[model samples]
Target: MNWYVVYTKPKWEKKVAERLNQIGIECYCPVITQIKQWSDRKKKIEGPLFNSYVFVQLLDMDRNAVFQVAGVIRYLFWLGKPAIVKDEEIAIIKKGLSDSNVSDVSVTAFQVGDRIKLESGVFSSQNAIVQEISNTHYILVLESLGCVLKIKYK
Candidate 1:
């Protein structure tokens, strides 16, 4: 079986993953917990790490099964075909999130136009360019992934 990426409706990653699992479809929706502050109080909440995205492992013939779940929009496509994520990549994501050493990870500032290799975190081992930076977040262009990531920080 191969792992395929599924795109979900906005903020539906977790729900879609849960529904897929309930129907015996193996899926993965990586999540993270963070503190959210309200005007009156602060609380910890868990949210999908990659917004609107989930990974499912299944045979190509079973691809249509995922559509039965609500909020699943479609399979992500790359180069005119369903985007396939390697098993090793999935394993690495799981391992990185589970590793205790990653708990203390922090973001550092980078000069615009600097080429950098990510050492850890979700895009670990990937090369990216510091495209832009602002007070709240920074943008990174991961050429290999063919995506621009805008990461926010305190």
Candidate 2:
């Protein structure tokens, strides 16, 4: 059985994983506990590490059954084929997420022209491309909205 990535509907990662498991399909949806602050209080919430993607371990024959699950949009493909994720890489992600010292791992080395998804703030879930990088912040260009934003990472 190889691990393949499935894209889920918005905010459906956890639910889709549960449904797949009920059908005897091994699924993984990595989540992290985050402290969200508001003017009145702070609360810890669990959220998906990758917003709309879930990993499933299954034989190629089981692909049809996986697609039948509600909220499962489609498989992430590469070069006209379904992308396969290695077991070792999945294990590393699980281990790193479970480690107490693992606060934040850089998803990618940000380079100019690389597209990125905003994980939080008012522009949460928006896509932008890196226009420039400074010592402390990134200058991103939101192409669809025709605007640029400077974001600082903590």
- The C-alpha local distance difference test score for the whole of candidate 2 amounts to 0.90
- Please write out the lDDT profile of model 2 over residues 1-154, one tens digit for every residue: 9999999999999999999999999999999888889999999888899889999999998887888799999998855689899999999999999899987643546799999999978999999999999877789999888999987643
- Cα lDDT of model 1 by residue, 107-149, tens digit: 3547999999999789999999999999778899999999999
TM-score of every model versus the real structure: 0.70, 0.70
RMSD of each: 8.4, 10.9
Give per-residue lDDT, candidate 2, residue 128.
99
Report the Cα lDDT for residue 19, model 1: 97
